[model samples]
Target: MPSIKAALSKPFAKLIAKRIKKWASQPLETQEKVFQNLIKKARKTAFGRDHNFDSIRTYDDFRKNVPIRDYEALRPYVDRVVNGEEDVLWTGKPIYFAKTSGTTSGAKYIPITKESMPTHVNAARNAILMYIYETGNIKFVDGKMIFLQGSPILEEKNGIKLGRLSGIVAHYVPKYLQKNRMPSLETNCIEDWETKVSAIVEETIKEDMTVISGIPSWVQMYFEKLIDKSGKKVGEIFKNFNLFIFGGVNYEPYRAKFENLIGRKVDSIELYPASEGFFAFQDKQDEKGMLLQLNSGIFYEFIEAEHFFEENPERITINDVKVGVNYVMIISTTAGLWAYNIGDTVEFTSLRPYRVIVSGRIKHFISAFGEHVIGKEVEQALREAIANTDITVNEFTVAPQINPSEGLPYHEWFIEFDIEPKDESKLIQKLEASLQKQNSYYFDLIEGKVLKPLVVTKIKKDGFQTYMKSIGKLGGQNKIPRLSNDRKIADTLYKLELTK
Candidate 1:
């Protein structure tokens, strides 16, 4: 028998499904209205006044008046706001700060005010609810749905509460659905990820867990632990398990490994949520890409990634973007992030429906030899290389070997395999061939002897986990960076292996 909450969820989900469908049909106009509304709402804020928001009547005006800026450029104002200043970026002091990693800098604390909470919370909720509506898979709602979240014990910086975005979100799970949430509150408050995962396995193994949600890598770790403890496959331990909700990293490389871990096929949904806001989600079952959120209090712009590296890049708004171009994303959001470069690059797959594939990070790429290799390209090559083979990559990272002392320059791959491919050497050959097919500059470099083919190094079992633990980054929201232009991380991995 379904609970009252489960019965009502279907109708509410249906409403959201209808709203999103209509929203997708007229994305450009919806985006324009969103931009205008955000501007009006923020016009009195310090940043808005400083940028002359009153003069910004249209998207063109917003673009012409405000230049796109990365985090560093806005740090001064953010710092001021952190020190109890009001209206520095947004209208008032933020209720909380979402702490996240910074690639080059140290940790970053992003302000999350009352005004912006819904953009992160309700928007993501609506995405999941709509998925349930579209698929008519409400059985999971009747059972338990375990969402792997960060530590709930928030730290305070000055007067503001600080914590992981996931942790903060957990505090707001609706009262009706709270009973179905898993991994006891005590377990959720455990700071260490390893200890927390073990506790979760102990608590959830005997429960009726129907759905699980988290990043693919961490979720895989949980599934492995479940199998190890129960001596049963994940599918057996949780027979009712039917759905996987994931985001943060691309699921392509980990798909086979996840299936093998669970021992069966399961429906999965992808989402695009950053510390800044929830951006997109897999709306339909058969869609190749997630639908962009045009009316979610976010105004978006795109700059061609190649041009972004140049002296001057042309910025294109939602109305002007074309399908199939790699563009770095820029956003002005309810969070008071205006003309901000979110550091993500994406490619549009559909125009009318406004669907996009997150290509990669702006800073995570290999261009040591002028052969620009982005995450999308590397992932595509890996997918092609493993096609028709039983190779299941558990985890992997790539870095450039540019030193002449290393003999020849090449891209080095450290792969942790779940299932080894039939032909190891052939895998390398296919990877090289696929890369050449994707990037002509890389092919030219290989032909000219300027760069050698990529080298693959099989990492020892649990090597990535060991490395991540050593660095104190083995936990929720922490990820192994896929590509680096230098040998910093790769050399560390080698040294770790040597010490072992």
Candidate 2:
């Protein structure tokens, strides 16, 4: 059985290697041309045999005719595909569906066609290779690469096993790295989320790891467990790790504590992957955020953040995007999605089409006490305040609560600390002052008595993890909600209050 598995895995791995090399060596122009061709193919497949190909020759024709779509709009089609409607969207069998947690809704299942699998595999491989190339730290002993991700295997219904995104990746990973990579399948597959976390912690201690990849919040939780079990600091356990790649959400608020936990500054990479598509990844280790893979098998569109749903919304092509302008990302992918809005907001850092930064989620804004605050503004204020004072944060969440007696809302900051400042009050004051200065709107709201003053609530070192576990959402792909966009989240926080 082992020999048969090896025989099948080796050839698949070789094919993946060839594809990665080819993609890396291709010129920018060639990549764009390939993307254009793929787009043409996808249009034909998406519209089906009912549409006339001769009528759609120009890019404008495709863009103008195909309506903009969202996950809710695509659910019916996805359901059809899953129910053995193979001839509709997929040319061949779909090996798995990548399940993703919805921001406001519930779980979403995205189909992974055999044809689309290579796009996911290549994007992921190139993301890692890009980091190594840019950092010039490719030389290291053969060690394990740990990916903290969701379980691929879904519960069996009617004796048929369903597979999620993790499963699809698992199926293809052996094709890319036959021997060196280790999937967190065994740990993630456990039925209970908490049990899975415990198992992962136990297994991580036994491995000689070199690369650790996951969402920042969950990774911090795992590190905390290591600290408790080994009686060694985070730096000691990860001292030999060559790289740490993280993504799924912004890590700015937790950056200082994360770096401190690892003992030394290590190379960090961020990725922008979604259930709909593997959208972008950090091309260089030193860069701030990931660059969009413009030439991949995905068509891109940007909706102006200020006027997202206005009739005839202003759309920018890859060549037209500018630096520092917030836009909601929309994508057309090989998975038969057309003009799909993935609900992510991004800003370009450079004029080059590929370089960009994830600013925040489209609807995730803090408006406690009428002070509208976006992710970038909050991150900037936090960074400035931390620079002023020598305090570090590992995990954090900000909630706006209405003071009933005062008839105003105040900002309550829940932060997990690594290093406590000598003057805690001073640190809190600086953070508040910075917010008032940097975010004038918030400042006016507070000063006008529209909102209450900022209050810092220091949490137990592992408070966020405990909260995540309590909600059955503590793992690699799961993330803590930073700015509670909903009132229910605030209610939950109110219930967990350890401070008066």
Candidate 3:
């Protein structure tokens, strides 16, 4: 039976669903309006003045006036905002800064202005509402919900508050769901991730946990802690826990392990949220990819990832996107990012309503021999290899071993497995077959004897965790890249002093 709250919310959920469908049906029109609105709003800002936004009458005009820039390229403008200048990037000073790391530029503070904050909060809220409207399972809405995230205790930078995007979003949970949210504010403020997870376990273990949300890797740690403490499968402990909301990494690789831990399959929603903007969310349970948010105050452009480095490479809008093409997604948002390259590559799975899947990172790939292998290829290969096998992986990464000691150079797979495969050679064959099937460049190289099949170098159990802890990135929105062009991570994995 549905709780009174869940029952009452169903009517509103249907309304939200209808509204989303209405806007999505005309993606290009919605996006064009958003683009015009963004330009008009930012006309008085410093960036707009510098780029002549008032005179920009078309997408081409806007493109010619503003160049595509990564965070490093835009740092100068951001510094002015960080130094407490109003009407610099956006209309007013940003209320919050979403701080992130793992880039060559160390820590990055992305602005979250008053106008842009609600998009982040509502994107998350709407994802769940759409799910409830479609599935009619609002019972989960009544039970306690937990979000495994960073410390919400933010630091003041100039006059603006600075924290992780997830942390900043924690401050904006809708009023109605406040009572149902878990891990009391005190426990959420714990700085250390391990300490936080333990505290979260203590706070959530006895509650009616219906919704669990976080990056899959961190949530796995929390579940392990619960299982260790109670000696019970997570599903048994929290029988009503049915819905999972996750982002930051693809959940396919971790799906088998999660289902095993929970002792059953559950419904899940994937979100594409970053410091810059909330780009997309899973709107349908049966859809291939997330529905791109065209009505949000963000204008999108995409260039083919293959030609991204070439000067004068083409940029296209939603109206020009085609299914199955890998594109480097770019944005001009209300947060004052003009033609900002967020570094993510995506593939369009559908064109009618603009569904997209995050394919890989623009800079994260292996082309040592012009094979041009990507993150999605490697992840898919690994998933194919372990399917229907006794293999339960802990963590995995792939890098080209260009200078292996004995033979021709090949890709080295550093896999940390909880349940090692009984037949290693067969697993490797499956992986090689999948890679060859997906990537034509890699297949051609293999056929021409330019490269060899990948080799698996098993890392010790808990090895990746130790490496992350040593480097001070053990948790909180941190994830290992599925593929790397260099040996930085590969070499470090070999040198880590292990605990097990």
User: TM-score: which candidate is best?
Assistant: 3
Q: Tell me the deviation in Å of residue 390 in model 3.
A: 2.2
- Deviation from native of the Cα of residue 51 in model 2, angstroms: 7.7
**Per-model C-alpha RMSD:** 1.5, 4.9, 1.3
lDDT of 3 by residue, 291-356 (tens): 898887999999998898887999888888889988999998888888999999999999878899
**Tens-place lDDT digits, model 2, residues 413-478:** 777777877887777787788888867788898778777677777777667766777776766577
Worst 10 residues of 1 by lDDT: 491-500
For each candidate in turn, the TM-score is: 0.97, 0.84, 0.98
lDDT of 3 at 313: 98
CA lDDT of each prediction against the hidden true structure: 0.87, 0.67, 0.90
- Greater-TM-score candidate between 1 and 3: 3
Which parts of model 1 are misplaced by more than 4 Å?
Answer: 404-407, 498-500
Model 2: per-residue Cα lDDT at residue 287:
63
Candidates by TM-score, descending order: 3, 1, 2
Best by lDDT: 3
Predicted structure 1: lDDT? 0.87
Ranking by lDDT: 3, 1, 2
